[model samples]
Target: MEAFDIAGLCAHPDDAELVMGGTLAREAAAGRKVALVDLTRGESGSRGSPAVRAAEAAEAARVLGASHRESLGLPDSALERTVAHRDVIVSALRRLRPAIVVTQHWDQRHPDHGMASHLVYDACFMSGLRNYRPDLGAAFRPRKVVFATSMTETIEAVPSFVVDITATFETKMRAIRAFASQFSPAAGETVALPFERFQESVELTARRQGQRIGVTFGEGFVTREPVEIDDLLALRGRSI
Candidate 1:
């Protein structure tokens, strides 16, 4: 219920950590309040039960140093941009009143990810309407909405900005690995790659994105609107 400087809204429990864990960690480390809101309990996941996923999500939140975490218990994979759904998210926006919102990219391989993006985008707009959902809370809207890349491979669309996360990259991986059910193979369950190899792939992806902005590790984000710069000299002079 507390206000947060940044809020992450995503389809499943681990989506936030996978897409922008380092950024979240960096924010918290810098004394910024952060929260995570999962649209679903990830009940329909192939490996973990909903309760297990919830516990894992809690652990991950701790690793990221988030102030709070909540789940909407929405139907996983079948999420839609219904008025009811929007109202729920609108309520959260009004309650948390985050200055910045981080969510899954609009273009993602998973249908749920894309649907979640639409749901958050619409809810953010509706939340600002004074006449809308008065029963939820006072109307409120986030100052900015940023999309974290969910693509596992290269994509045509380039990121609007990249956050240097070299210092928090390891913490990000720690948060992700908290979901043992997802990244770690259970007994008798054959995983495509060992946990170490899977982690290496994630690190490699961060390294590749970091190379874009001349950092050791980074996270990419896209914004629909152009970012404003009060002073051009304030920008990091890192080679593009």
Candidate 2:
């Protein structure tokens, strides 16, 4: 199994880039292996085909400096908490052996996003069961799991930590813009996304989140329990 410092598993191709590209870039820039795993091809999306999305995802991964990217070949917009779903993630966890895993928050307007959250969480637990799914790879689990909170209308996540992304914000934007098919469709596309000035919205949100931590840009993340801290002097988010 190839060991990785960070692994991101999300519902769709652009999900990882949208939520945690900066954190991934920071880790990769520091010589840590980062991997991205998508649960679906997003074939049901109003804009872009699966092939186009896959191409864009590859480019985004390159932009973010990720070491590996792959999809689990699950049905888009129809994710469920099933043994089969858990099995695939368990196998990937065993193979990748990532120390930390990042995923979307459970509270979401998009049903698939919420389902993906539950699926990933359960899969992480199942992966550690010694006898669970013996046909898959050996039992393995990530040391930590964190949920990313985006600038969405339906969610109000209180972040446990905020990653200062001032340096990597541009890289993250470039990664997101790689999906031209989704953001720049031709005439008569009629996409459902309210993509008007999405770039500005994203930037503004980052700036606001950054202000919370006295930074220029940031990305917020949440965890179910308290984070373990060894050194009280090592905290960075406090505004001094």
Candidate 3:
């Protein structure tokens, strides 16, 4: 596969779309090479089988215009921070060599999400080490690692930045809906709640975030390190 500009590394198949769909769509629409790496096949999800979810994920990737979508085959709902697991992620990072990586927030309600956050962060650092895993791929480090909010019941901290995704909001929804097993009642699959309610909640969150930045729709992300701005005028939402 070709190098990606940005990569979304998440715990489960639909996690990326749930949290950063709009951002991914916007990036891909802008002709930036974007990829998604799902840590697991979401086999533990109540609604779908692994095979079913895999197909759904592919559809979602297509809708989002992602350059590549892959799963690490990690145990769902049972993610751990181990050398083997970290090495797998590190290999992918070196192979993709994305300049920026987006992952779930460190503090999350789901254990897998939290674990994935730590795993991705550590792997990013390890990927930079020349001797970490020479057999997998050449050492390469991503420039930035940003955290996107996912399945968190509360917003513990304010976002460091918000990406305006008004133009791609609908496209994001379409990509999310591709996971019919999780969000579509007509798919004859059991879900935690009605599909309509789930959709409404997602839209509501996007709307609230968008309101924060005076946009119709947006996605928020937090960065552990302070973002360096080359020019204030170049920043989004800045008046020329």
> Which candidate has the top score in TM-score?
2
| Alpha-carbon shift of residue 156 in model 1 (angstroms) | 4.5
lDDT of 1 at 71: 98
Rank candidates, TM-score, best first. 2, 1, 3
Candidate 2 has an lDDT of 0.88
Tens digit of per-residue lDDT, candidate 1, span 157-217? 5778989889999999999989998865678988777888878878887887788888899
Best by lDDT: 1
Evaluate model 1: give its lDDT.
Answer: 0.89
How close is every model to the real structure, measured as TM-score? 0.94, 0.95, 0.93
lDDT of 2 by residue, 3-63 (tens): 8899999999998888898889988998989999999999997778899999999999999
Q: TM-score of model 1 relative to the true fold?
A: 0.94
lDDT at 91 for candidate 1?
89
The C-alpha stretches of model 3 lying farther than 4 A from their native spots are 184-192, 238-240
Candidate 3, run of 10 with poorest lDDT? 149-158
The TM-score, computed over Cα atoms with residue i paired to residue i, of candidate 3 is 0.93
